[model samples]
Target chain A: DAGVTQSPTHLIKTRGQQVTLRCSPKSGHDTVSWYQQALGQGPQFIFQYYEEEERQRGNFPDRFSGHQFPNYSSELNVNALLLGDSALYLCASSPGGWNEKLFFGSGTQLSVL
Target chain B: DQQVKQNSPSLSVQEGRISILNCDYTNSMFDYFLWYKKYPAEGPTFLISISSIKDKNEDGRFTVFLNKSAKHLSLHIVPSQPGDSAVYFCAATYNTDKLIFGTGTRLQVFP
Candidate 1:
């Protein structure tokens, strides 16, 4: 029973480049959420996906988007990245429908240089 | 506007002592509150949570107390251990599913 898993633990991209991070939800989980954590700050919600569709979104711009596959895995895509985009992108999974506990992955550390 | 806030940037406590981390929210609509613990280079892990219907919730050494009247909440760790040292974040959620997080409080448990 592995918990949420994320790929490309660390990445480096230049300004204006696009990057995609991946996440596999925990077994039996159907909802996936994305968050961004800057250095010395807590995470800010980016969006959430359920039933292969985006159910809720935060105050992020269009440059940040995500998708959830039928297998409950997710991908976060960021386009036209900026230096401020350099942060830890976290993926959390939970059981859909209610206030289930969220299981988080180690996260992908993106450094826009 | 920041809905949730953890004003304390850091807290230091000796081992075997108690640690109390505080949080406040400006939104009265927030119905659920959660606390998460994070270490460097890792994502946050859920530590505890409380719903607005309850004033307090406890699990082992960790306890979360919510004061709806004051729009405040606090996490108390009794007999703190070195492993408890980490950055703590307070998050709130309204009827909508999305969660809003605070700036976080770094806790240092000295042995």
Candidate 2:
């Protein structure tokens, strides 16, 4: 079975520009969550989507947004990128609700210059 | 403030020794805890988890112990191998999809 998949394994964007990262959840998963991992640091939860609606969010600001499609695929959008925004964007998928085993993608590495 | 914390930024152990990684959380309401191991340039991979209801959970050579009273948890690896060396992260959640993570500890197993 196919696991979670992410696109554009690497990206480069300048400040004041917008970037979009895509993710497809693993088979049989119904939820998708986004996380950002800074160098030498653990990942921080960004947001989660279920049923195409954002069910929960973290401490991130309005500059960070996401979307979940009908097929359980997700996209993370960031506006006005900052140097601090340079991190590995991870997409995790779960079977259903919270506390379930999460399947993670390789992640999209974003370099905000 | 970090809800979850891993005090050790890195650790080294001789292969075949018992390696213990510790984690703590400030939130008493966190009901679920998980451990993830990551290799360089790769995403974190789920290792093992412990629910609040259970004090201990074991899988293969790995074990996790949870102490609800202290808001602490630990992961134990027996006869650790060199391949076991990786960055380990502790995560916790309170019945929500959001998981709070620690800074992570890099484990190095030396033969």
Q: Candidate 2: TM-score?
A: 0.97
Q: Model 1, B18-77: lDDT tens per residue?
A: 999999999999989999999887778999999999999999999999999999999999
Candidate 2: regions farther than 4 A off? none
Per-residue accuracy of model 2 over B66-98 as CA lDDT, tens digit each: 999898999999989999999999999887658
Candidate 2, A1-113: lDDT as tens digits: 98999998999999989999999998999899999998878899899999999988889999999999999999999999999999999999997755456788999999988
What DockQ does each listed candidate score?
0.67, 0.70
Candidate 1: clashing pairs of residues: none
- Report the lDDT tens digits of candidate 1 across residue range A1-113: 99999999999999999999999998999999999988877788898999999888888999999999989899999999999999999999989644335788999999999
Give the Å error, residue B92, model 2.
0.6
Docking class of 2: medium
Worst 10 residues of 2 chain A by lDDT: A95-104
Give TM per candidate. 0.97, 0.97
Model 2 clash pairs are none
lDDT of 2 at B111: 98
Report how closely model 2 matches the true complex, as a DockQ value: 0.70
